[model samples]
Target: MQKGSLENHLFRKGQEPLGWELRLKIAIGAARGLAFLHTSEKVIYRDFKASNILLDPVYNAKLSDFGLAKVGPINGNSHVTTRVIGTYGYAAPEYVATVP
Candidate 1:
């Protein structure tokens, strides 16, 4: 995390924009991280945002802050019902409506 959060590199004033290649790499890395959490770990990442995505010196994206994470549905359950929690404007529309 030498580069800190991706949000800092993205929205801080006077910083150059990340190029398309780097952006794509970050996106892919983030997606892979999420996928691993969902599939292998069976965890629901309730707080996924730019501020939670840390970057290394080489710009590899890594997820951080699992405080809001929850164990996913198990057995025959289709979903887990829980109180909605996450940063404002970051929740999906379906998630906000259904809390699934």
Candidate 2:
């Protein structure tokens, strides 16, 4: 990742703000990556955040760090019940409140 993490580009001190077009491009790329994992691979990426999205020199986004990934529900099960885990601030409020 020549550009390093998206977080660094977006939030790190002294980094320039991303242009609107670049932001949209990066966002779409990241979404596509997550969509592939969820739909094609049947995997849940539990840690999805700016820091987990790496960018190439052209600002193409790629997902990194799958340490928290898990196999999605199978065998006709609609969901999997597991303790909530991931970065503290990144989880959806509804998910955090209802998962337990």
Candidate 3:
């Protein structure tokens, strides 16, 4: 994302008015990135939301903050993370179930 490009949430505000085409495209890009992470890479993006979607000047979206992400489970050990992480209202439903 660019240094000063509009963020997904701020752009969504009616008063902000980030033209329709750009918004839609940004949304699509964000979805594709997430899909790549989950299906193609067999990973779980435990956190996702408009705020975390950083957009460039051309409305290109990028996923940020993978530092907390863990690789897919290999051992029989539980992936039931007890960390209780992620931003509110954007955390995956499955994550909440796994955590204490």
- Candidate 2 regions exceeding 4 Å error are 76-79, 97-100
Q: How does model 2 score by TM-score?
A: 0.87
TM-scores of the models, in the given order? 0.86, 0.87, 0.66
Error of 1 at 67 (Å): 0.5
lDDT of each: 0.91, 0.91, 0.71
Residue-wise lDDT of candidate 1 within 31-67, one digit each (tens)?
Answer: 9999999999999898999999999999999999999
Of 2 and 3, the candidate ahead on lDDT is 2
Candidate 3 lDDT by residue in tens digits, 5-91: 345346545656666887788789989998898777857776676767787766788888786566666576555666877776667
**Which residue pairs come into collision in candidate 3?**
none
Q: What is the full ranking by TM-score, best candidate first?
A: 2, 1, 3
Question: Where does the lowest 10-residue lDDT sum fall in candidate 2?
Answer: 76-85
Q: lDDT value for candidate 3?
A: 0.71
Angstrom error of the Cα, residue 45, model 3: value is: 1.2
Query: Taking the tens digit of each residue's C-alpha lDDT, what string does model 2 give over 1-100?
Result: 8999999988889999999999999999999999999999999898999999999989999999999998887998765656888888899897788664
Which residue pairs come into collision in candidate 2?
Answer: none
Q: What value of lDDT does candidate 1 attain over all alpha carbons?
A: 0.91
